[model samples]
Target chain A: MKINTTNYEEYFLLYIDNELSTEQKTAVENFIEANPSYQKEFELLKQTFLTPEHIEFEDKVLLYRLEDMEAKLPSTFKQSLYRNEAKVIEGYFNTTLKRSIASVAAIVILIFGYNLMPTTGKQNIQNQLANNTGLPIIKNESSVSVSANSTQNRIAQNEVPKIAQNNTKPSKTLPSIAAEKADNTPPVVINESIANSAGQHVNNENEMRASPSANNTTVITAVNEKITSNETSIVAEAKEAFENINTDNPDRTIYIANMEIDGDKLRGFTRRIGAFIKRNKTEKEK
Target chain B: MTDKDFNNCVDAYSDGVYRFIVKNLGHEADAQDIVQSAFEKLWVNRAKVETEKAKSYLFTIAYHQMIDHIRKDKRNNTTDNFEEVKSNVNISANGELKQILLKAINELNPTQKSLVLLKDYEGYSYQEIGEIMDLSESQVKVYLHRARLILKEKLVHLEKMRA
Candidate 1:
């Protein structure tokens, strides 16, 4: 094949690099056969760029280096183990701290609740006694009895009765049975009527004491059956009057100063107050 | 990639990569270290790197590693007069020609040295060098030509100095 000698200079590097097409390669080969100088230049460039020593060194060193790199790489099982251990330790620390904090908070709450709870056992006992007592008056009686009984138990045998007397006698120090019996010697029916009359008299006295005329007057027959019974009758009459007044004016039972006002009156009063407040606020702004 | 696969890639490419690094760096110890480091990087990216392209990937790592070393050294002191060792150059005549050529390569711009090494010693085509260096093929070729001219000029000067 005839080769283009002039173009060989431009394509010489490509030819040496094995990058030229088959036809171009054949042309370069034929040209090299024709020109010894071109051939010499080719060999010189090749020698300059691609030394045998460097190529051989690269080949041998690369294989050895790669083997070393392979040996340095961690095995799959070791990597997996490392990752798993990390996760497990993280989970353990996170959960342990969380649980510990929760436990500590719960203990603190328990202690706070213990302090907030009622600590007075005596108060609790008194509450129970008051709850069990039929009357409010019996609560004090039970309180005294419990204190006396516990105190008597703590005393020595020789000094027990005297201590019991000192404790119990004070609580039972009201008028003796004989004195009370003597005071209550009146007939049962008379005593009941007296009590009823006394209650009515007390109520009438309280009402009269609050009146303007009471300052100039005196409660001269407070225990007198006639006046007490008379006051009782007056209360019954007043209560009947109030009942009749309430029934007559079912929707407006408020009677102030003989003036019967309904709920509408209060609402009107409130609205007037509110309007006055608004007017005052507007005036202050001005 | 599995450990076995990574090891296999290492076995296939470490020595060549190391020799290439040594040639460029001119230091046997740094070359060996850079080669090991390159393989380690390959091992790290084994999952992303395909076995078929592992050699190119390894060379790419070694190239970057060598550049990093140069940059690091430059930060410490001036590497402006530093020399490169051509992988394919013979060490005859007390390493004078190799030293001169390396000095010439170091004198070339960063892009020129990289382009020439990729093209000549690594045996990468102009297009392949461009892909690795993120430049156009024409740019790589231009830079490579400039580098070769510089080396030739430096060699002539060294020859004159010998005379």
Candidate 2:
């Protein structure tokens, strides 16, 4: 800056602040020397700069943290609980893994328990099957052949004689059902419910004779149909139970040594959490 | 910063920071409280703070706290009388120029006063003062220069009246 009457103050301020280089400092000094009146202004400005006061913060000791406070403070609550901190904090990951395994096992138990529960509906089905002479053949073809009042399934290699004895007893309506079968018409659906209301058919044309012997034959036929339908329901329920377990070998529903959790959501959650734990462990090790 | 470095900071900078605060506050207890708080912050952030920057960091925290304290307690302590100060400066011996200068400093507002304090008392550069007070370098220079001119007027007035 050209140091003169109008702008000497700026230069003087910068001069005192030591912002000016040697060349600028020399120029300012020469200008001040040339002008005696501005020298007093410069002197008075210099007096404005404050002097340092010697004062001390006496409580410096209060702010000191030379030692780790955590080391000094005993774990009073942990000690009172009579638990080792190391034992509690460590092995927590292993405990979590064990818990996941245990949970999966618990899930397995819950599934089997629910599937195998002897529900009254299923008990009726089992009782019906047991009454018919326990054989897998009856379960294989769930529907009976209504046209001949004969079961549709092949005769069991062992139980054919028992079924033959039951079939030999002729019913009065058997001839009429056989005549419909010979004509290739659909066999009539029978209803012999204890509810007389339900015994009424929506299609009245195919209604059967209501003689007492005909009624007995109708009741027996309806019972077999029920067992047939119920057995189908049991097959479906068993299939659902097997589907819950991971069966790489479809024959095996569950094997403790080769168990694989099937639910995608549960598997993904466990995998992410396991990966997170493994990452943390690796980072800590590093 | 290490524990040794922090202790070293306390020994070295506590006096300078206390002096800076008490001068601004005009109250010993408040200054003591502010100085302690600044050091406490230094201790808490010792890991982040380095030994080289601890002094400026402490002063920065202390200066801000002082400003807040002063704003909260406006002219509450040591309320100055300009007329009384003028009269006293007029009559006082030339030996007491430092005392007269201090009174002149008290006449300035907080920002201007801090500029003067940081510039003259601690010998901080305009850049360093800007960092402490969160001002631009040019702003510090302009504000400080204006404050210095006011002080100069006061001192010059006294000088002319004395003659």
Clashing pairs in 2: none
Give one digit per residue, the lDDT tens place, for model 1 in A1-286: 3456665544666665445799988878778887877786565444335332343234433433333444454587677666433443332235567456456445444543443343343335334434433222112434434433332222211222233233223222111111121233333432344344334434444454444443322332332333435344443443333233222222422444686545445544545544554554586588
Q: Residue B9 deviation, candidate 2, in Å?
A: 0.8
Looking at model 2, give its docking quality level: acceptable
Structure candidate 1, residue pairs in collision: A61-B15, A62-B14, A62-B15, A62-B16, A66-B10, A66-B11, A66-B14
* CAPRI level of candidate 1: incorrect
lDDT (0-100) at residue A157 of candidate 1? 15
Model 2 lDDT tens row, A6-48 = 9999999988877789999999899989998889888888777
Residue-by-residue lDDT tens digits, candidate 2, B26-54: 77777789988998899889889989999
- By summed lDDT, the worst window of 10 consecutive residues in model 1 chain A runs over A173-182
The candidate 2 chain B region of ten consecutive residues with least summed lDDT is B85-94
| Residue-wise C-alpha lDDT for candidate 1, range B1-163, written one tens digit per residue | 6666776776666756765666566666677778877776876777898888888888877888888898887788754322334343444433555555656666666667666666666678877777777778777766665566556666666777889
